[model samples]
Target: MGLYLPDAIRLHARERGTRAALSCADRTLGYAELHSRTNRLARALLTAARPGSRIGFLARTRTEAGEILIAAAKAGLVTVPLNWRLSEAELTALAQDAGLRVLLTEPEFRSAADAVHAALPGLRLVIIDSPAEQQDRQEQPDPPDSPDPSGPAQAADPAVPGYEAWLAAHPDDDPGRGGRADADEVYLQIYTSGTTGVPKGVLLTHTNFHAERAELEESRWQPGSVALNALPLFHIGGLGLLQMALSAGAHSLLLPDFTPEAAARTIEREGVTHTFLVPSVLHLLTELPGIERRDFSRLHLVSYGAAPITPALLRRSLSVLGCRFQGKYGLTEAGGTVTRLAPEDHRPGGPRSHLLGSVGRPRPGVRVVICDPGTGDPVPPGTVGEIRIASAHNTPGYWNRPQETTELYDARGLLCTGDGGYVDEDGYLFLTDRVKDMIVSGGENVYPTEVESALAEHPAVFEVAVVGVPDDLWGEAVTAVVVPRRDLPRPGEQELIDFVRQRIASYKKPRRVHFVGELPRNPAGKVLKRELRARLRQSHQ
Candidate 1:
């Protein structure tokens, strides 16, 4: 009987009926309209699927994406936001795993949706088109034999319904809590990045989200705040950011997809006060043409995470955006951020400036412990070990994976983060790297983030990923894959390696360096080191 997801919409609708709730492209929905539409969508979802069923959403960031989440919560269904960036095969695998009863997708992903439906005939498909697309379809009549473009898959399959039509058919009245789940029940099932292995669905309950909001620090919502939501909804950072904004009655400006230009334009035009961007996005923004001239006066805060951020990039972002920066450290299983690096800690030469390199202390109501990865025994402070966290925001477990779920926690019940890091004497959590990403070269342990951080300080190095490769004499050879800054003269491989050697221990330096145009990153801006390792191994073979 605690706070429900739909209750946020209902409360906002009653209190701020005429205020803008969500804006994307050329359309904006007021709180009242959003509440009413979600109610209808909830009833529609229930008509096609049953309560407790897994409802899937595979689309870009849009107002309809928010509608699906609120609707699923109201209909007592679990929302599984699928990554649209995934391939058809990957989508089919996740769809099968979730056993999704209904899938809400968009025209851009019609082929992928078709593939999923081909695999699961029982799965209902509903296409959600942008308002502009719908308007274009209404203006132009479809010609015979020509493939339908700028519209839903309704023409291809009679059974699959268009989202607007399906929603309009249902009553606008609130779908009473007859089928709603309790606060402890699963509300969102976000899949892991699967860098190490097969992606597992992390089951985050309603209480998990509520717990996250209660601990929000610098990113806390302010009244009448306009939030720019550019991250994809499939990622926890994206969905969680949207939820925080909506829950606080903040107007959200949704981006269909992230582009440096689009994000800059939206921030200036929309007068966005708060937003979240990954370090990679921030790098792009700082390097953008005429970026310094952009009117970021209204922008208040830029929260970033999901991957290791170099101090250089953080300083550059601070200089360019002229906004308070907050760093977050978290994963999907943690339901978002468990630690927040406050803006005050970001100062370069301040008394607590050394903490800038750390991910900061755990948020209120969260306890972080460093544990030996092998023995699961607590490690002393300042000793590198697996990061363990205990918090109300931690997911109950992974969906349908009891064995792995049980292993996710240690005997002490702290969720093992699988990240190698240590807490300093000042209580700051300094991340080294993913435990799996650690490189053991000639019996010396080398964390890639440490090497990458050092390499990133070089003027020529734009981005870098350090990994261990097969070696004859050594167990694994330390290798660095780098993307050099286009604006700066490219540094030689040995020169770049020597740059890191001067800063860190020589044994931790990269034995080999490979330059690339760009680093492969997942939707959440996390570098896909697994893919990079595989590529390097194949190339060596």
Candidate 2:
């Protein structure tokens, strides 16, 4: 039999049954306890619905949420984790598209559940949040709350029920009902941000996840490593990290939310060995007051990615954290991370450190190639082109999007990552920018990431985003949106322009600069260039 994620969890439970597996706030769960609870939950789910059903879960970073994910994995159910940040309308639409048989939510999203139920009548809504009084009355006999059984379940007015009471009566034994999951079995239905179009689900398999875990295990991870959990669970970064920690028998310290102060405290108190952050969060941690006073001696690895890191900021982080700072580059469709800069590469004052700006070489089992964007032919090492990846971790295709899947995946099954970049002679990947985000000024290609990286070097600039605005003569003019340092005096737009001009070509410098309090970002902490383009169009009109 092929190895699967659930099988790994079962093995860990047997080997380290009593060892602490997950810690969130003050609550802690051991491996055996987690596995048993997840098994019970899986049995309960099996009793309620058939295997291969799509189930929507709406909750924050709670221990119960983690339990549900593990249970879904064991039960052969496709779990669709909805972002709490999405609107009710978006949630309803996603549920309908996924053909969700069940809508599981906490009390915090009760009203949103009602909205979704109104739109999707066939969905069965189960509220997992039990009232305090209900917990107190667990000893007393209570009738299990069942859904409205009077009428045929329709697609518009869905049935609603409670989860605690249903699971209380079910025995904690394997249901032995789910079909065997093969290498190609769809394990998850994660949705991408609908920036380019309506959000479509991305199907990932057991093989894809296991392949990624194997790659990580072969690299730097070790057993019993304590990793801090701060990234949102809805995204691949957070979910994949959690899976890696579990597979390694590591302890995961979950942060209820992502705040620089909270993260610093957890690192000191829990002795967190590894953590991941984007450029924005790294800046927040380094810039926070009294950061130097914190104890980060226990920190071993700090992996950063999801955006480009400025050389100056990277240098500052190295000095401040005094830890092994690595970089990862990948996308959601590739099951989280495909390339990682090793810990040894982070040594200060070394040649490897000088390549800090690069995204590093591809990891094992991943092959990367650069091809001309227009001609689809291989490009030279130094020439900029579209980056493509062939890996076992890549998704089979976009769910229900055959046309898009065909365009994204070539006939040979290589995934065409919509990123523009080039590989150096030494095989290090240097990202120029996103293909859609590239600015054409006077027929010259100007990558926004290059300009943004240069602007981030300015002492007074706190954050920056580069985009192209419509111009009559140039067709599109380079524009920069900046967030200045809070304590520093606002620098003139011309000063900011001059800052980038000194580092790059004159055409690449921002022709227009706008100071803003913050830049629009998605759930993954990537700046939404589409939003910036929309704002520019509005201003021009």
- Give the winner by TM-score: 1
TM-score of each: 0.95, 0.92
The residue pairs that clash in candidate 1, if any, are: none
The local distance difference test score of model 2 is 0.80
Clashes of each: 0, 5
C-alpha lDDT of all candidate models, in order: 0.86, 0.80
Clashing pairs for model 2 are: 121-154, 121-155, 121-156, 121-157, 122-155
Model 2 Cα shift for residue 354 (angstroms): 3.8
Point out the worst 10-residue segment of candidate 2 by lDDT.
Answer: 151-160
Model 2 scores a TM of 0.92
- Candidate 1: C-alpha RMSD to true structure equals 2.7
> In model 2, how large is the Cα lDDT of residue 319?
89
